[model samples]
Target: MRQEFTIWLTGLPSSGKSTLARLVEAKIRDRGFPVMVLDGDEVRTWLTLGLGFSRADREENIRRIAHLAMFQNRSGVATITAAISPYQRARDEARRAIGRFVEVHVSCPIEVCEQRDVKGLYKKARRGEIQGFTGVSDPYEAPLAPEVVVRTDRESKEECVARIMERVEELGYLPRGQVRCEVIVPADLVDELGTNGSSLLAVLASREARLGRAGGPVTAEEWEKIEQRLRALGYLR
Candidate 1:
């Protein structure tokens, strides 16, 4: 891990913030830099588990994510965050929390985002089934001075990814000989490992937690399996 730094990608839902963040991480990883991505949706289940879409909850959500990212950065890891993060104040708070925060606006028009609503969130939002939706029911305040602006509507994924890498380098996140570990693990195994199968599960779970302190959504059956495995291993109460 290198000295701590943070890159925050913010935009409306479906506007490629998550995609760009992943691309950025890929590029950084390829450069041997220690990096972790913290995306909002993945963490919502655990870190901000009880938070709703109300204004206050949303603020707290961003706050929690920012705080965790800052903590990770302090630990000498580069952090990349992706979230709708609609309010300017929330984004600013993140930048302040992480002194080296790089704010990147994954700018794309609402129409473009709606068209790419592969998840159908836009349609659902239009039907009023989802409230507090960005670029629709709620306001998406653009960053007044984002460090970099990546226009998803106008760039290819490769190009956007490259731009993100370039920005990271420009912002000093990349340098020669930075070593970061990238661990890949299976989901089912991660859910049942009982804290002994592998260390990657803990790392992934920790990443999920840092993203927003959101815990994984383990079901009763899954919990039973983990308990059984742990008891069988004599590793739990």
Candidate 2:
């Protein structure tokens, strides 16, 4: 059976945790890995609908999700959870419960999160319409030493996803000696591709498979560019 692990993404609302989780999940699934994403909002609606946003209720919510993640991990399924897990103690407990866990701190300033809030939750919190909202009326204890930290305010979604993938590789979650290659196209060239660039890579990978090549076809220039960026981002040695 494949190695199993859980990636817990903790951050404030609108901090891009869910978005990053989905991106990571897609990449892992594309590589033929068994993966699942436990989004906070969906879980709350389905599993913990009666639970309010009080500190105690939030702790219970996290515990429930952590137990579910642990169950999946024991079955050799990789689990990714995105939640505004406000308290550090609750997250620590989760890490203990889910033994092969990777804590990803999805960080962004409260101001930035408020600006990106499409649901108007932040505005409501600011006006005292909602109580115990993380990063607003309630406290948000940032992770002290998470395995990975992605700054959604400063980095692009692609970059954040790449960083997490690098961590997964380092932790040996991916197949042995198989490092996922992510091509970071320049912004000016992004429009030229006319697709998300994954489609292009998929085509190249398919051709390589037909040719029996060990690795996909990435030009020397492209490889160098990707390596340089990864090294600069401290993802590669």
Candidate 3:
């Protein structure tokens, strides 16, 4: 059976959470995995109507979505949730509810989000037309230690997607035998290391000899540590 997991994208409005979720959904489908996207706005219209913008209501909304994501995960399906999910306590509750959760923090400043607010919601919030709005009248508590953090303000859409994809692959959620190893190095280091740096080559060779006979790719955290060590050793700039 395929391994199942939930990818939760939480951030301020217009932070590119939905865009990244859609891109990830498409990539998962292309890789032959069953995936579902539970967008916040669409869910509010469908599953969470009659719920106001109060803190209690917001918690209930996230709870409902987390339950749904858990259901999909039980059926061997991956779920991508793009929600503002403004409270740390609410997000912690959701993570507890769904054991296999991967929190992806879609980080962008409120100023940028307001500028990208094509719906004029932010303008209204500023003028007191909208009350209890997240990142405006209300608060937006960001994730302290999410599985992945994508800064939409600084990164292109494609780069954001790539970062999420790398996390998904690291988590062993990709289809079996379809894992792709990506080595990220600085521009200056790329020329010196070429296609394979000595450190990376050694790591890959060792993993191939071990896991090739066993199974699975290296964990994302482990790869990150390896990269850090390489950087410290001057192998990566």
Candidate 2 residue spans exceeding 4 A from truth: 176-237
Clashing pairs in 3: none
lDDT of 1 by residue, 102-212 (tens): 888899999999999888999999999999898889999999998888888988988877776677667666654555554333454456455555343233344434444
RMSD of each: 7.1, 16.7, 18.9
- TM per model? 0.75, 0.73, 0.73
Clash pairs, model 2 backbone: none
Off by over 4 Å in 3: 175-237
- The backbone clash count of each candidate, in order, is 6, 0, 0
The true-versus-predicted C-alpha distance at residue 181 of model 2, in Å, is: 20
Cα lDDT of model 2 by residue, 33-114, tens digit? 7778888996664344455777878887787778767766664568999999989999999999988889999999989999
Q: In model 1, what lDDT does residue 148 have?
A: 84
TM-score of 1: 0.75
* Per-residue lDDT of model 3, residues 84-181, tens digit only: 99999989998999887899999998899989999999999999999999998999998989999999999999998888888877877664445333
List where candidate 1 sits over 4 angstroms from the true fold: 176-237
